[model samples]
Target: MSRIVFLEERCKGCRLCVEACPAHILRPSGRFNHQGYEIMEMDGQCTGCASCAVMCPDTAIRVFRSVKIRNTAGEGAA
Candidate 1:
């Protein structure tokens, strides 16, 4: 499963990540951080897409994607 982490303190509440999220998992959180700006929230539905991170001007979001390896056991068996 893919996941994302947001550096809350570095976020400037620009909401660019929210708009760049294709999975619709990012939203404007009603809470404020130490900087007094509304933060963003993730719904744990990240698709490993870097769209959010690319759009974030502050580089607040980090994405981690799990690589799945498929077994090729039968490729040369026959």
Candidate 2:
């Protein structure tokens, strides 16, 4: 699974990230940030595609991907 982090203070509420996300997981939050603009929030699971991060004009979004390990030894033994 992938996860996304947002720097609320740096966000300008441009909604670029929201439209850029192919998963449709991003949305504008009703609450206002310290800068007085309504920030964006993740509403669903992230695919770690970095679409939102690239579209963010303020560079406030980040995507982290999980690493998976495989059991290589067990497969050959059988």
Candidate 3:
């Protein structure tokens, strides 16, 4: 799974992330940040492709992925 964290105060609300996100996961916060910019965030449907992170001009967004592994033992297992 992947998660996105938005740095509200650092955001300039330039909409670059919104345009860059292929999944269309980023959107305006509708509220102003500490810098008075309409921050952007990845919606619940984000696929975690990191498109937004690359396009953000202010570098206020970050995408992180978590890797999971499963182990099982069976009769045929070595």
Candidate 1 accuracy as lDDT: 0.89
Candidate 2 per-residue lDDT, tens place, 1-78, comes to 899999999999999999999999999889788989899999988889999999888999988997777768767674
* Structure candidate 2, residue pairs in collision: none
Query: Over 4 Å off in model 1, which ranges?
Result: none
lDDT of 1 at 55: 95
Off by over 4 Å in 2: 71-78
C-alpha TM-score for every candidate? 0.89, 0.86, 0.80
As for lDDT, the candidate ahead, 2 or 3, is 2
Error in Å for residue 40 of model 2 = 0.7
Pick by lDDT: which candidate is best? 2
TM-score rank order? 1, 2, 3
Question: Considering lDDT, where higher is better, how would the candidates rank from best to worst?
Answer: 2, 1, 3
Of the candidates numbered 1 and 3, which has the greater TM-score value? 1
Query: By TM-score, who's the top model here?
Result: 1
Candidate 3 regions off by >4 Å? Answer: 70-78
The digit string of per-residue lDDT tens for model 3 on 1-78 reads 788899889899999988988877778879898768888766777677888888887788888877766665575667
Better of 1 and 2 by TM-score: 1
